[model samples]
Target: MLTLSLILLPIIAGLITLAVKGETAKTVAVVSAFAELALGAYLYSSFVPDATSQFSVSYDWIHSAGIKFSVGVDGISLILVFLTTLMVPFIILSTFGNNYKNASTLFALILFMQAALVGVFTAKDAFLFYFFFEAALIPVYFIAAIWGGENRIKVTFKFFVYTIFGSLFMLLALVYLYLLTPGTHTADISALYQAARVLDVETQSYLFGAFFIAFAIKMPLFPFHTWQPDTYEEAPTAGTMLLSGIMLKMGVYGLIRFVLPIVPLGVDKWGFVAIILSVTGIVYGSIIAIQQKDMKRLIAYSSFAHVGLMSAGIFSRNIDGIQGALIQMLAHGINVVGLFFIVEIIQQRTQSRELSRLGGITQSTPNLTVYFIILMLGSVALPLTNGFVGEFLLLKGVYEYNVWIGAVAGLTIILGAVYMLRMVQKSMFGVTSGITEGFADLTFNEKIVLFPLSFLVIALGVAPNIFLKVTEPAVSQLLSIIK
Candidate 1:
C-alpha cells in the first residue's frame, strides 16, 4: 500500500491541480509534493538496514506469464527514491514566483513526472519497469513542447524519437528474455537474473547490447548524443533540469540494476569498448563545450562529459567503480540541476546566455556570483566538493581495473577545470557589460531554490560517508553476484 501510494499520490495531485486556479494551484501542488516527501522520509527513517527487501509490496498481476505487481527497495533504491522525493518538492517551490502561463497544467505535468519516475525506480518486474520507463517520457515531452524556448517543437520531436527508437529495441530484448524464462516463467527482475545466469554467453551478449544501446542513447553518450544539446537549449529551464538531473540517471540506474549483474560475462567481454567510448565522449564534450558561446549548449555538452565519466565507471566492473558511479549519479544530478537553474536565473534577468555577450556579473551581483562560483567549483571537481569524491572514486576504480584506461580518463579532470574556469572567467569577471550592469541579485524565491542545493553540494562533499553507507550493502550484494 505504501508503495502504491508513492506512485499514486502525484497522479492524484496532478488531477486536483488541474481544477485549481492561481495561487491555489501552486499551493495545492506544493502541499502534494510536501506530503509525498514526508512519506518518502518516513520510508527512509523506518528502513531496516540489514534487510534484503525493505518496504516491499507484491501482488500477482499476470500468472500465465509469471509477472507480478512487485515493488521493493534495498538501500540502493531507497537513496534514489529519497533523492527523487526530496528534489520534486524543491523543484515545485523553485517555481513559486515564475509566470508559468498555465500554472495548473504545468504543475500537473510535474506531479505526473514525479509519479512516473518513482515507478521507474521502485518496479521489480521487468514489464512493469518498461511500462513506467516509457510512460515517464510523455509528460516531459509535453512540458518541453508547451513551455520551452524557441524551436521547441523540432527539438522535442528529435528528443522523443531518438529515445523511443532506442527503447523499442530494449523492449524487444525484454520480450526475448521473457521467452527464455524457465519453468513457470517470470518477468520479475530477480527471476530474470537467475535465468540470465544459465543462458549461453552469446545470448547474454545480444541481450546486453540491446539494453546497452537503449541506456546509452538515454544517457546521450557521444555518438548517440546528437539530440541532447538542442533539446537542452530549447527546453524550458524546469524541463531541462528534470531531464538532465533525474531522467539521465535512469540510464545509469538501469546499467547498475539490470545490465552489470545479470550479464557479467557479456560486460566483461565488451566493457573495454564502453570504456573507450566514454573516454572519447569526455574529451569530445569538453572540447566542444570550450568553444560554445551559448550557455545552455555549453552546459549541455558539459553534461555529456560528466555522464561519460559515469559510464566509464560503470564499465570498470569493480566494486569501487560501481559504487562511485552510483554516488556520481546522485551528485551529478544535483549539480546539473543547480547549474541549469543558474543558467535560467541568468537568462531570466539578462535575457541571454551567450558567454560572448555577457560580462562583469560579479561586480553587479556578488551574491549570485558567489553561488555560481561554488557551483562551477563543484562542476570542476574541486576538493571537498561533491564532484571531487565521485570523480576520485571513479578514477580510482578505473585505475584498479586498468592503469592505461585510468591515465587516459584522468585527463577529464584537467579538461573539466579548464572549460569550467574559462566559462566562469568569461561570464562572471571583467568590466560590466550593458546587459550585466543592470543585473539583479537572486530574488528570495531564487535563493530558496539555490540554498539547499548548495548546502548539499558542500555537505555531501565533506561527508559522503552518509550516502556511501546507504549504497554499500546493495553494491556489495551486486558485486557478489557478478563474482
Candidate 2:
C-alpha cells in the first residue's frame, strides 16, 4: 500500500488540483508534492539495502494476457524515486510567483507528469513499464504546447514524433519478448530478464538494438538530439527543468535497468559501437554548445554532452562505469534543475535568454550572480561540487574500462568548463547591458528554490559516499548478474 501511495498520491492530487481555483490550486499542488516527498523520505529511511526488491505491491491487472499491476524498488529505483519526489515540490514552488494564465492546468500537468514518472521507476512488469513509459510523454507534451514560448507547436511536434517513433520499436521488442515467454508466462520484468538471457545471441542483439534505439532517442544522443535544443528553448522553464533534469535520466536509467541487464551478451558485443557514438556526442555537443547564443539552447546542448558521458560510462560494462553513471544521473538531475531554474530567473528578470543581449547582471543582482556561479561551477564539474564527484567517478570508471575512451570522453570536462564559464562571464560580469542594468536580485521565493540546490551541489560533492553507499550494493548485484 505504501508502494502504491508513492505512485497514487500525485495522481490523486492532480485530480483534486484540476478542480481547484487560482492560488488555491497552486497551494494544493505544493502541499501534495510535500506529502509525496515526505512519503519518499520515509521509504528511503526504511529501505533495506540488501533486499532484492523492497517495498513491493502487486495486483493482477490483465492476468488474461499475463500482465500484472506490479511495482517495487531496489536501491536504484528507491534513490530515483526519492529524487523525483524531492524535485517535484521544488518544481511546483518555483512556479509560485509566475503568472501563467492556466496555473491550475499547469500544476495538474506537473502532478500528472510526476505520477507517470513514479510509475516508470516502480513498474515491475515490462508491459506496465511500457504503459507508464509512453504515458509520461503526454503531460510533457501538453506542458510544452500550452506553456511554451512562440514556435512551440513546431518544436513540441518534432519532439513528440521523434520520441514516439523510437518508442514503437521498443513496443515491438516488448511484444517479441512477450511471445518468447514460456507457456502461460508473464511480463514481470524478472521473468522477462530470465527469458531474454536464454535467447540466442542473434535474437538478443536485435532486441537489444530495439530497446537501445528507444532509450537513446530519449537520451537524445548525437544525431538523434536535434529535437532537444528547440524543445528546451521554447518550453516553459519548469517544463525544461522537468525534461532535462528528471526526464532525460529516465532514458539513462532504462539503459541501466532494462537494456543492459536483460541483454548482457548483446551489450558486451555491441558496447564498443555505443561507446564510440557516445564519445562523439560528447565532443560534438560541447563544440555546438560553445557556439550557441541562446542561453537555453546552450544548456540544452550541455545536457546532450553530459548524457553522452553518462551513456558512455554505462556502456563501459564495469562496476565503476555503471556505478558512476548512476551517481552522475542523480547529480545531473539536481544540477541541471538548478541550472535551468537559473535560466528561468534570468528570463523572468530580463525578459530574455539571449547571451548577446544580456550582460553585467552582477551590477544589480549580485546575489543571483552568486547562485548562478555556483550552479555554473556544478555544471563545469568544479571540485567539491556535486558535478565533480559524478564526472570524476564516470571518467575513472571509463578509464578503467579503456584509457583511450576515457581520455577522449573526458574532454567534456574542459569543454564544459569553457562554455559554462563563458556563459557566466558574458552574462554576469563586464558592462551592464541596457536590458540587464536594472535587474533585480532573486526574490525570497527564488532563494527558497536555489539555496537548497546550491547547498546540495556542494554537499554531495563533499560527501557522495552518502549516495554511493546506498546504490553500491544494488549496482554490485546487477554486475554480478551480468558476469
Worst 10 residues of 2 by lDDT: 46-55
Quote model 2's TM-score.
0.98
lDDT per residue as tens, model 2, 1-483: 888998899999999999998989999999999999999999988887773888889999997999999999888887788889988998888887689887899999999999989999889999898998999999999999999988999999999999999999999998888888999878988888888878877888998899989999998887788899999989998999899988887888899888888898888788888999999999999999999998889999999999999999888877778778888888888888888888888888888889999888998886788888888898889999988888888898888888999999989988999999988988888898888878889999999999998888889899988778888888888888887
**Stretches > 4 Å off in candidate 1:** none
Best by lDDT: 2
* Cα displacement (Å) at residue 28, model 2: 0.2
Per-candidate Cα RMSD to the true structure, in Å, reads: 1.4, 1.0
lDDT of 1 by residue, 131-156 (tens): 88898899999999999888999999
Clash pairs for candidate 2 = none
Q: Global lDDT of each model? A: 0.87, 0.89
